[model samples]
Target: MMNTYSFPLSTLGLPNLMIQTSDGKRPVNISEIVFLESARNYTFAYLTDGSRVITSKTIGIFESPFAKHGFIRINKSIIANLSYITESCKNEGYAIRLLNGQWHTCSRRRTSKVKKVIKQLKTL
Candidate 1:
């Protein structure tokens, strides 16, 4: 039998996870897991509302292979987990609306890339 321990996502030290067990889904805590393409490393974190801190990994090393599935590269330093996104509006600047109803701005330079990936997600 596999041993399991029940704990809040925060206790796991993963700061990018934005989801919790609710609405009758499986009780398995869903966390944002990061897989780096360059270094081939995996890091996990939890997202508390809008703010999140990912595990220690060089910014340039990790790549969101699932970016087309909601993960977005917001800037050179971080990737936003779109699983938490609720709404988005591209009026003057690019911004992401999280499920918690929080909006985070994406740098102008990364807007195009983020948009491209998000668009692909829609088609899939």
Candidate 2:
């Protein structure tokens, strides 16, 4: 089972994430994040503004927290924000297009889960 951590600023009524930066931790609104890509032990956070932030933590560490905020692990190395997904491409493969026009293919093993989550999101 994956471990889950409560967002630190929840009590303060802020949906923000204290992401680790080179200098220290910085607060970023979760809604501003579009996706997260893993790079070995590090993870890259792509924001809606087209900016990227690198954190020195494994992607796994973020899986649970992000999930609670509507982010889904579309594949082994990527966790995408559901709100940022603009389209689903079924003709080519199990892929999704983000607001930034970047396409990410879901792994075969994760395609079912991704589809289910997308369906659920559409209902809300």
Candidate 3:
């Protein structure tokens, strides 16, 4: 069986970085995020638990913080957590497969960055 995982907000090393979800402010562990996708004016955060949360903030709103937490912005529409990526997919352009089996493609400009991040993760 796949191991179930969870982390309380207080235990996360981040200080006061909270994600505003539908219910209210939720303390999200940065590493728990599998990927993020932007749809029109909203951004959806997809987590490893297979739960998706909508955030009113734009995808760019997360760039800085996510970068500090192992997230690589692969394209204008998608940002993925390096820890959750299962493989580097070159079949269709440049893409990555998450542990949860979700695929995200990188834009031409960001492909090198994704490769660098994947290499960094392997070294760690």
Q: How many residue pairs clash (N, CA or C atoms closer than 3 angstroms) in each of the candidate models, in the order given?
A: 11, 0, 0
Off by over 4 Å in 1: 1-44, 48-54, 64-70
Model 1 lDDT per residue over 1-124, tens place:
1111121222253333332232322222234432111222333333443333334444453444444434566755456654454556777787766544446677889888867766654555
Model 3 bad stretches (over 4 Å)? 1-17
C-alpha positional error of residue 85 in candidate 3 after TM-score superposition, expressed in Å: 0.7
Whole-model lDDT values for every prediction: 0.47, 0.83, 0.75
* Candidate 2 lDDT, 1-124, residue by residue in tens: 1111122222244388899899799989988888999999999999889999999999999999888877899899999988778778776568888888898999989999988988766665
TM-score of every prediction relative to native: 0.49, 0.85, 0.81
Instruction: List, residue by residue over 5-69, the lDDT tens digit for candidate 3.
Output: 22122225744457887799987666667888988789988877999888899999888878887
Residue 34's lDDT within candidate 1 is: 27
* Candidate 2 Cα deviation (angstroms), residue 3: 34
Clashes of 1: 11
Error of 2 at 87 (Å): 0.2
Pick by lDDT: 1 or 2, better one = 2
RMSD of each: 13.4, 7.6, 5.5
